[model samples]
Target chain A: MILFELIAPIVVMFALSFLHADRVRALLALSAFAIMLPAVQLLLQDKPFPLLGDYLIADRLNTYVLLLASVVGAGVALALMTLQRHVQVHPRAYFRFYRFFALFWVGLEMAILSNHMGLYWIGLEMATLSTVYMIKTNATRAAHKEAWNYMIVGAIAISLILFGIILIYAGAKPVLGEEAMYFTALLGAADRIPSPFLFEMGFAIVTVGMFVKMGFFPMNLWLANVERASFYPVAALFSGILESAIMVGFFRFSDVAKIVNFSHLAGFIFVYALLTMFVVAFLIYRAKDFMRLFSLSGIEHMALIALFWTSGGTFAALLHFGAHAFIKPALFLSTGVLESQGRYHIAGALRGYRGLKGKLFWFVVGLLMLAIVSLPPSPMFFSELYGFGSMIALAKSGHHLPAMIAAIVLLLFLLSIIFYRFVELYQSMKYEGEAVEKRVYGSELAALLLFAVGALALLLPFSLAFLRSIA
Target chain B: MSAFLTGAFLATLVAALFATRLYRLLMWYALNSLALGLLALLIGSGLNDPALIISGVLTLLLKAGVIPLVLKRLTQRFALTRQVTPDIKVHYAVVLIPAILVFTFYLAEPIGRMVGGNANSVAVAISSLFLALLLMMEHRNVAPKIIGFLMMENALFLLGTTATGGMPMLVELGIFFDLLIAIVVINLLFRREEAVE
Candidate 1:
């Protein structure tokens, strides 16, 4: 099943590459369903399934991430299908998009499933390469430049990650022998790894690398720019799926750090997350473009998720990840809908429209934004509540108390400002003009509804229990 | 022999930082890659490891031979400006390079103690990494940056071989595959950059 999950995307990519563009679109829906099936099966498995002598494993954490990537991959494909109906994209470009999109999914799934650190690095490198073109396809000078920067930064980050992995292997070699390459082997021998300092250094270096990859503060330069430059569907996948997979990879490393009793590691990530969230909140408030706004919003959500996980609120962290995974794409795709109508600013997104379509658009966009701000009853609301609750518990245990208090205060302050900004935008979205019935494509609406419903459904007892089970 | 090759590897990379001419930089990169390949081969034979031997041969053929040649063809085809101008001045680089090397030497000291390998070789691997990063940062040209990236990979490969005797064969193969894909992407990006300029 794991093999099929890994192979199906590549098969789809090759098949689409050979098909004509018109035919490719029809097959993409079926292709997405095919690619998602194995992932669904993996996600449903009660026991861990180790494959290929433990080089790949469908453990609970990774399987959940795999499901996220597969669902978002299919969602992005469906959204793009709707985009094709409204826009006049060249046939060759359309065909090329699906080809690379499939490749991106392959890389992401491979990275998530790999138990060997070296193979994990390789998978991420593949994903990074595919992402460069996804942005560059925008065909603007700024887009090209942003893609170029993304590649350079990504390449550098990946190299550093490799260096860190080698260092870890170096540290582990004396203790675990050849078994050191496998994550579980290293974890099993964590206390016996001979060189705790080297292990810690490697973890630090890997954290720095992931800070860049996951868009943490001080190394998040390329993220919003790249996301803003990409086509919205690609942006959706970038935020919704790719970032989640990378976080899962980092989490796997941190699990080792935890077992090895690197107490400072959690604090480092916590401070980093708090700083990222606070800074990105202001950036979101000041953002002029809707794409940039949501991109900054993604940084904030990822920071919050990191905070939750590192504070020992693993359940809240995973819950927040699911919430962001579902809602962020919906928000970005909502912007895509508005973008098609020449609305790129939050202020006037609904100014000219009227009647039921406008009302529905306003409601959907508003609900998603409300969820972004973690309004009551939203999944984000519960996640943030439990996340902060865990964080305060950690603080009372005397871990970086001053920094934690300041961060919590700063977070609440900045969050209110963000809430004010969203409310201001919601007010601006009120259209008092004459009714001009705007017909949105069914696929686009369906795509938005799909993710929005997914986000909302997380509030259900079943989803909550499932999330707790995974945690 | 590994010591001499490691020294040569670091030396060529340091020289590449000062190579003002594009072809000269590529030549320096080729030499650096050649030293890495030879070091891998030497280490592999000493350990009697077939995987490392194969990795060494591939590194030589691909990094030293094919990639540089492909890059040369790309530069000629694009008619990109051959004269290289780095944003950082040479004198500052001259002072800073040794500083970076010294810092990493200290950085690798504890790990070296733990591994009980030649501490100098670990120091050299890390210094080479810093020099490679400098090579990337000091250049404004796309070609140099790409070369720096490849050199970065070579330095990492050297570190793995030196530090761990070699990763699993599967990982080595995957790394090689990723490098090939990266070069293809680099080739395309170089073309696009040239076209844009």
Candidate 2:
């Protein structure tokens, strides 16, 4: 039945999690396959698949994100095969590592599929719990600090969302009873809820929690700190899988606003998006490290995504995520290459990598940044264009006002900040003409090329339809 | 009875705000969860809800008993410094706590409109959330930070039992699972922290 098909992947991945230490690679590969098979299967189908009487549903958004998450999961596993040499691990430890990694994988899958608020909370908590272990793979002082900060912050965020969920229950109990927290049930009964004000309060609270989970503005600092501490593969899962999962949470929360015509939710999204755009633009200039710089760019991308979502461009939102998810792991792991080789000089001396290996890394990283900045030929460029167009459309639909004008002003400020930093960095490098040469290791060239192709392929006009027209 | 129990639970968290000994903080958490459990049980009996009754027993057995015992053993296993007050000055905390309570009371006015039960209890539950966040923001040490997280969960349980009269059974079970697993993983991280030290 449909239930078995949906449940099999998690069950298999959970089983693989118990593999012995020597089978760490196998455990990882099988876990990736477990996630991918069902994801690909779902993607191939045009219809939504609901299981457990609609508590867990796989729709266009969920399936597309799953396929995207699996791609990142596979990329991380594949990249690890070549790059995991630096992490020396005993058999027992290796087994333990993969077990938690598999759990994190399964958790993300569950989170996307969940329709019941309760199931969604559990899935997210599972992912967060596993991440605490993942970030601790390096037992250094800074890593420990980052891990604890991550754990504490995640706990707080999850609890806030839970409180919000309970509020939804409180508000809906009289009309819909306990089933009010179930997405399917709530859909039919949302309007009959006791008070609209309480409903907005709950939705707003949940959105705040999602914002933190997605690492925007004020909560953005934690991602960089945690990434700096995590193993590269584990961090890739976060950038790719976990971040997208949180975006789904955002989409779902925003859908409630759409269902009930709650203007405050739209206003909330616009305010945070503008503030995040303006704030991180300045913060990116102050980033002292490369990973930190990339992490800050994540906020910018998320902000753009928020803009499109608030403007009601559902397809644009999905396309932006598709582009970002595929491209981020390559960008993240290349930075891993630079950091590991001790040659990741950001905006400093013209001490760049030389020779073939250096040339490949330099080219890949440059391409990644270009994609991040949404230059032409990159998928993000198109997505950003669509986002702006949609915002204008939203304005045409009676949404433009003093607030939208202020948002545009904020956008202009963000543009000036970004261009200013680029000029500064360019001039700084120009001053130090003699660049340092650094060596790259393994199939670095082939991997970067592969990633580059994958990223570029997402931008094709037809491929955009694949995601945009998703169910 | 439910209101008194929830109030006693909030009191433990406030006391923990001032307590310097880590062991005492854990005990306070245990007592806080015990109050939450009793409140759940009392509410279940009053409403005649079997799901709430099951939730109450689980809260009593796991959060009140098992989790604190695990944390106690964790506290004893390492020569960890018992940091009761990690960062914020007492005067600042003293002023902040009441401000949080009042702010949440105002917050409850909007929240109070949706509740099917006592509006004052709803205000208290919402305030407990702020108080828990204050506990977290006030501390810097890992142990106290972790305890602050536990306190947050306890506050949420109060929210569920009082505001909604208890969530569906399935939701409560998922929550308890998360709390327990979080502690286990956190204990591992603590061990690694000790090893790093």
Candidate 3:
């Protein structure tokens, strides 16, 4: 069962490529959804098994990530179906898109579930390569450039990671005595590591490499370019699912190394997270393109919340991850719809929607606005509350300053204002007469409803417990 | 054993310096790899490990013989006649290389004491890594970039063999696989660049 969950997606994706018919692609996606439902249930049971002599394994921490990937995978398939219906592209290229997206999804799953360092490295490389193709799927000049930047940076990061892995193995050889690079084994024998200084140096380099891949500030210039150039569904997966996997990597490393106390690292991460949120908030104010604005906002908020997780705010982090993953894609997909109708500007789209007097569009806009801004009863609100509570706990433990915690909360509140203020400006835009007829289909509407309701219900007890376990 | 390694190391140093002549870079790389392979062979013979001896011989053939030949062919195919001018002039590189070598020896002395291994091996590995970086920074062309990447890999291999007495065979295999994939990808990227031009 464990091996099946790990390898099934890769096999399914490879098989999907051989199927030429659109109907088959749709069926494959439905089958994927069916496979996912059982997999997530099994994962929630928290069983662990090693495959191929500890090279790969499944555990509780990755179970949540796999479930999230599955949901996003299914959602992307549905969105792709909508895209195929709307765009008059050739069937060959369209099917290729499906095939590549499936491969990308499966590769990420493998990356998250990998237990051995070398296997993890391979999985990450596979995921990066697959996503490169997705980024260049449309083959625009901008897409090509973005893909190039992503690939080069990704390869460099992987090389550094590999180097770090070698250093760790060298450092561990005296104690473990040969060829034992499994995470659990390493963690169990962590105290036997010979040179603490070398270990720290290697860990720092590895962290920086992973941080670059995670799109943290200063290393995140590639994020906007890639997100802007990718198709909407691809962008959605990049922001929602893939970033979560990178976060899982960070979490796993921290769990294994126990190098610095979470609070100490959280202090450094918190400062950058705040800077990212503020900078992105300012950019969002000036952003004209709707998709770009949402992408920037997603990057900002995700970094801040991820920092919160590092501060021992695990429950809050999981909640925010789930909420953002659900809401951001729906919003991006709507932006795609607007873009498809030739309304590139957010202000213009808002004005046009008003002219059409579309209640459904307004409802989606309202739900997303509420969700992104973390209004009451929204999953985001609860997540942020728990994050703040964790901050307070850290303060009481004397690991963090109370004043600093208060300031971060204040900063978040102000950032929220900036986000909604743009929505206000967008809503208030003067009408240019109905620019393009809205052609939203039933599938899109169903996807939006599913995301909205799903985001709301994810705050329930069972999910909260799962979040806490992994936190 | 120490005396033999010392002589081989001195020969390698001389060869590396003399290889600055435009026509002799491949010969220099071969000599460097030969010295490394011989060092590995001596270490293995001292440890009485036939597997390590086999690996050492394989390295000598692959790195010393095959790789340099391939690089020579690549240089010829590209008509890359322009001599590589070091970012630091050759005279300056000569001076800087010894300074780096001395510094690395100093840095690795304490580590060598702790690990109870040859300090010179660690120093050589560090110097090779620095030299590879220098190689990469000095050259702007694709061929040189490939050479730089290969040199980095060679340095890493040296670190694996000398510092830790050869990483797990699985790791060695993984590194080899990664390098193979990287080279293929680099070739494809260069092809795309040529097509664009």
Candidate 4:
């Protein structure tokens, strides 16, 4: 039953590619909703379910990610359904877009659910391959360049990850034979593995590959560059679903690292997260294009999630992950509508829009901006609060008082810069352009509203408790 | 036999680093992959591992034969520049290459001891990986970079085949699937580049 549910979307989307564009869009949205039913069932189940004689496992972490993927996936598909009417893509191209999107989704599922490390790597590579073409959906020169940049970086990262996986297998195979590639087996025998040094090196290499893929510090520009050039729906998925899946890979491998007494893993993640946030914060401040601003903000959010995860704040980290998953797609979807109506910059762009729909657009963008900045009533507020509290606690426990305090102060200052920049961009919005009336699609707004509601609901006590329990 | 094959593999990768023309570089990659495939077969037969044997066959058919054909076709179809010169001059790379090979041997000693595998073979595999990365970094043109990326995969497959015998058959199969899809994507991007130009 579990296997069927997971495979169904890939099969349906592949078959639907032969149909016309509208039907593909319709069925894509429909299949996303359909999958949510099983995702919820999987999420509600208590015990881990192993399949294919243990090659794949549905456990708490992956199930939680599965549910998140479903929700975000559905929202993006819905946004595509509506946003397609405005964008002038060829029907053949549109059909192909959804087909690749389906493959991307399946790849995420495979990556999240696979118990074997090799399978996980393959899943990530599959996802990367699918996105390489999807980024070039517009066929623009800039789009092709970004796609090429994304591909080269992605291949390098994937190759490094493969090397890391091989090193890990070499370290583990001595103890557990062929079963060493399996996560459960590795975790179970981590303490007994004779080659701790090799394992640690492997884990470190894997983390570096993931950091490169996730756009940490030095390699951070690829995500922003690619996202800016990509079709908006694709950008939404890049920010929302792809980032979440990559982090899931990190968490799975790091789980094994932790068991093996790999002490440097946390410090490694913290430094990169800190550096990434620092870079992203400045980039966000200077972002002139709306998509670039939002993309930079996505990097910041992912960095914070990594920080929270490493700092003994699993609950807060997962919550932030969930909240960002919903919030970013909403931001992209709303901004996409604005772009479709000829506004894609941070300068006084509000003047170009008029009417109740225009007001709703500004209002949606404002609320999402607030949510992203972790303002009150948004779940991010609590996530950041708890995340910081945990970071300080981690510091105290490790007796790195001065260093931790300094890091926290720097992070706080960066956050303020980002928040202040968002405000400046918003305020500057009121000062420009000749007012042109625009009609916003109800379906687009509805998709945005669905995600907005999900973000807000994540703030509720019940949702917090549910997320904590999952964490 | 294993050492000889690995040495040949390393030789092809080194030769690839110096190739100044498109066809010569692709020929080097194909030979590099052929060496890796033969090494996998030799090790698999010695270990009596059917999975490793299958992986070797697949590697030969796909990496050594099919992928190069596709890349060759892409170069022809796109009329991409045939005279390839890496941005990092050959003189500098000549110095850098031997340094990497020596350093990796030192680095892989402990890993080889831990895995109970041949330290020299592991070192060769690791060095080849670094050399492939250097190959990618030096090239400014797209075809050589793509070949460099594929060479990195060959280097990794060599590492896994030598260091751990081979990964599970399913994982090896998946990697091949990814490689095939990557070629399709590369072909698309080449077409797009030509269109843009």
Candidate 5:
């Protein structure tokens, strides 16, 4: 069951790439793989399996991440299908795009499931390499340059991570001795490891590298450029799924290694997150392009919310992760459709939309806005509330009180107004001037509904408890 | 054995500081790798492990000899001009080198006592790290950056050997494989750069 859950999507994706049929068939294969996720989770409940000389493992953490990946992966695949239909001229590269997307999805899942640090590094590199190709698929000069930047920065970060891994292995060898690269073994003997300074230093370096990968501020130049240049489906996955997988890795590191002194790490991340959010908020106001603006805002908010996780903000991060996972992709997919109809600017796209009524487009857009801004009864609202509580609790405990208080106040004020503006935009019918001839299909609506229902269900007590335990 | 290892460490450090041009940089890398190889051999001999000795000799031949030779060929093919203007000026490096030396010695003292190893090995390992960082910062061209990266890897290999005697064979093999792949990727990147130009 364990190996099947971990390996099935990878094998299926590879196999699907070999099929010389329509790209829609590959989409079906992806959906089928996504379906296996819940079944696998059901079987792996409270059961752990270590495989391949302990290079991989199936545990609660892996299961939770796998579930998240499957959910987002399904949404992305569906979004891609809609995009392919909308953008009619790009027929030749369609299969290739889906193939790369499928492979990227598989690689992300593997990275999350990897137990050995080396395997994790390899999985991450594979994901990076695959995504580079994806970014270049648009065939624009700007896209190529962005992909180049992504590859170079990603290479540097991965190399640093490898160096950090070597340092850790070197430090741990005296205590844990030979063949102890697995997370479990290292964690088991973390307390006894000689040269705590080396371990801490390694952890710090690795964290910085991973932060670069996660699109944290100061290292986030590549993200905005990539999102702005790449296709919308790609933007959605980069913002939604890829970011979450890296977060899972960070969460696991915090759980097992505990290498970072939380207070200090939180302080560092908080400052950057706040700065990023402020910059993004300002940029959003000036943003003429809709997709770029929302995607940039998502990246900023992701960094901000991620700090909650570092500061012992638990249930909040998990809920926000799920909420954002559902909403961001829907918005990006809608943006893609708009772009296909020769409307590139957000204000233009929203204006003169006479044909898209009671369709999946508006419904998806509405849900996405609600979720992104964490409107009432959405999982994000509860998550943000809980996150603030956690921050307040930590601050009261005398851990960087001023910074935490400032972050809370800033997050609340910014998010509240952002939500209000989004709601206002959705309600206004100013963009109903021209009719959109091609109507959105039933399957796309089903996919959007699936995500909306999933996000709503997550707010339930039973589901929340289940997810919290696994996470 | 300890004395030989200490001598190699001192020689590598001196080479790193004195080396000037690209050829000198390669030469300095060779000397550093050779020191690492000898240290690995000594550790193997001390443990009475034949396989370790063989691997040590392999490290010496491959890292210290063949790899540098290959890098030299690549540099020649690229026809990189001599680095007349390094990122760090000579006077700054001259001052920085001694400061690093002093700092490493101070940093390694307590660590050496705790780990119960030769303090000189720790000092050399730390110095190599700083040197590698310096090499990376100094170079602007792609080829030199690749060389700098390779040197950093060699430094890490030395740190592994000196700190823990040597990592598991699997890990050593992984690092080597990673380096091999990295070199290929670097070459590809250089090719792309040429194409763009």
Candidate 6:
């Protein structure tokens, strides 16, 4: 019975998907927020919310993620409305669009909530499949190629995850049998699970597979490719919400690793995090499109957040993730406004407008860009400051070499190259071109302002007692 | 018995690697799935595990039986060329396959010890995984690549059965369900809208 209730949103989504009416889709999304609230509330009360079959259990770790994902959905819906105002979405395309939208969220929600690793694998794979259509929303040749690339890589990564799952399950067979595959049970008996080395090795593979799902470093080619070709809202979905969800999933693995050979797992994560941050930060200067630039910078921050996770900066990391969640979508939505103008280059896009109205529009863009770079007063500023502190502390504690490489060396490169390139882009903007300055769509402005306010609000210290000790 | 089952499984993968005819590739998959089912059955009998037997039954019926039929019908509908156009030359693939199998045998030693299973079986399964990846990479068309994916899943199933005796029944059910969905999605994706046949 509890299982049925847990799947009720998916049921509702499938039923509503056929409607294709704006009102029905809005209602469907709002209802998702409604259903997710109880789970979040359950976590807030410090109570375990377990489904009947033990397929899913809600803990504090996932509660924050659930709340953020729910909000990202609503925010993206709002942004989509803003996009719809300019681009003529065919009435016929509505059903498929909304169906994929529903499928993406349902799969994501399921992934976040799944307790069984196999169930989680299914959920993430389902979400990946759904996103293929969303990425192909534009239907251009480039869109097809990007979506195809994304699908191929995502499938390969998921296959790797499957192999990892089998290995770990097999490793646990002697001590725990099949129950060894359940995360809660496995974590409880991590030390007792036979062949601890096998478990660790399998988990290492799973962790790497997940990184391929979420980031572009080492395999750093696809994130910008997919985002640059996708419609902005789809870009926002994958970049802001979906990737964050995967991070939270990885966080759970990290959380469980406290019981499973913690030092090795922590060290492994740290190396990857710093490596990704350094490589992507240098590559940020090479971003061709403005959207790709935003994505590359987001990757840098993602690496930083992963770094925070590894360095035991739990609060600062979650804070950074939360700040990024708000700032990224808003940035994407606003950028959608510019990209929707059918221009190729940032200079060309900027050249399509003129006058005071254009300046106001550019102001909005600048605000988002500044917020993303963690410029002062933006909550990212504080979150990032805390991250720096955490890294410094980590360096002082004896692992000075890697920490210094991440904190000082790559940090210098990031600021000089990425941020400076951003400034160069800022200076290149022109308010004089072919198209006239247009009034900001109300929904677009509303979403942007909501994001701006959310970014500011993230600065206010939410006393998360749970994360206090982890630091 | 396990060695024979694993060997037959690996042979099917090797056969698929060299098979040019599209129908022959599907046959290799069917034969591969059949070997995996038989392997599961053998393990189930040896361990007296009903869940393994149940998984064997499912694999035999759905993967070995139903899926190959579906692929056949799909080929007929698409009117595709009978032969697979692998990007890699045949002679090169033959060399790569054996090299991969040898490398994985070395690679599987540590993992095999950890599981305390039939080391050769585990080694064979691991090698099949890489070989399956090669098959997937070799294909430019969607069908062969998906067949390659299905083959990879078969390899994992063999690993699970041999290493763990068997995974939990619920996880197996979920895995099979996911495979069903994957096949449907792959078909739909290839067919585009208004799927024929």
- Evaluated with TM-score, which candidate comes out highest? 4
lDDT of 2 by residue, B57-171 (tens): 9989998899888887887886567866647788888988888888888988866765745687788878888877877777767778788888888888888888888888888
Error of 2 at A449 (Å): 4.6
Model 3 per-residue lDDT tens digits across residues A252-271 = 66664554234445555667
Models ranked on lDDT: 4, 1, 2, 6, 5, 3
lDDT of 6 by residue, A1-471 (tens): 444544676567667867777678566655555545554455565436775467777766666666667667767777676565666555545556667777777677778877887777777877888888777666566767676677777877787777788778777767876687678888787778767766776777777878888765677768778888877888788877788767866776676665777668757876787678778877777776777777878788887787777766788898888788888888787776666555454653554445655565566667777778777877667777777777677667765657465555666566667778776666565533345444466567666777777666655555345445324
Residues B1-197, candidate 6: write the lDDT tens digits.
77888889999999998888888999999999999999999899889999999999999999999999998998888776677878889889878888998998887778777766588887888788888889989988767877888898898898888877888887788788878867776565556432312
Give DockQ for candidates 1 onward, in order.
Answer: 0.72, 0.81, 0.25, 0.83, 0.24, 0.51
Better of 1 and 6 by DockQ: 1
Among incorrect, acceptable, medium and high, the docking class of model 1 is: medium
Per-residue alpha-carbon lDDT of model 5 for A54-151, expressed as tens digits?
A: 76676766666567667767776766665656654255355656566666765676677777776676667667767776776666667666766676
Docking class of 3: acceptable
lDDT of 6 at A210: 80
Badly placed stretches (over 4 Å) of model 3 are A19-23, A31-38, A44-46, A49-53, A84-92, A102-106, A178-180, A259-268, A271-281, A341-344, A350-362, A399-403, A406-435, B1-164, B178-197
Off by over 4 Å in 5: A15-35, A42-44, A51-53, A82-107, A190-194, A256-288, A341-344, A351-358, A397-403, A413-447, B1-113, B116-155, B175-197
Error of 4 at A468 (Å): 1.9
TM-score of the B chain in model 5? 0.88
lDDT of candidates 1 onward, in order? 0.80, 0.75, 0.66, 0.83, 0.67, 0.74
Question: Which of 3 and 4 is ahead in lDDT?
Answer: 4
Q: What lDDT tens digits, residue by residue, belong to model 4 across residues A1-471? A: 867877887789878887874545677678767768778888767758875568788887788787877888888778777655767666777777878888897788888888989988998899999999888777688888889988998999989998999899988897899899998899899889888878888888888888888788898777878888888888788878888888987877787787776458787887888988988898888788778888889888888988888776989999999899998888887776566545454554555556676677678777787778888877888899999899888888877889988998999999999999988877776565445555677777777888888787777788778777765
Structure candidate 4, residue pairs in collision = none
Interface RMSD of 5: 3.2
Runs in model 4 deviating more than 4 A are A21-24, A340-344, A351-356, A430-434, B193-197
- Compose the digit string of candidate 1's lDDT tens values, residues A1-471: 568666865687758766765766868766876777887777766657875668888888887777777777777777787675555556666677777777787787778888889888888888988888777666667778787788888898888888889888988888788888888898788878788888888888787887788677876546878877767887898888878877887888887887776577776786677778777777778877778878877888888887788788888999899989988888888776565555454445655546555566667777887888888878988998898999889888975778777888888898888888877766665543333334566576777777888788878898788788876
- Which candidate, 1 or 5, has the higher TM-score? 1
Residues A1-471, candidate 2, lDDT per residue (tens digit)?
544654565566556657664555655565555666767777766566775566778887788887888777767766665555555444555556566776786578778888888788888889989988877766568778888888888888888888888877777778887778777677677667667677777787787887887677688688877887776666667888888888887787677666665567677788888878877898888876667776777777788887788788777777788888877777777665555534345543334667777766676666666666666787777777777777777776785665566677778679667656655554554354445554566554555665677677776777677777762
lDDT tens digits, residue span B1-197, model 5: 76686567556655554455777777877887787788789888887766567668878988889888988877777676656346777888889888887887886676667556555776676676667666666766455555566666666666666666766665566566556655554554444445445
TM-score of chain B of each: 0.95, 0.93, 0.82, 0.96, 0.88, 0.94
Which model, 2 or 3, shows the larger lDDT? 2
Give the Å error, residue B24, model 2: 2.3
Ordered list by TM-score, greatest first: 4, 1, 2, 6, 5, 3
> What TM-score quantifies how close candidate 1 is to the native fold?
0.95
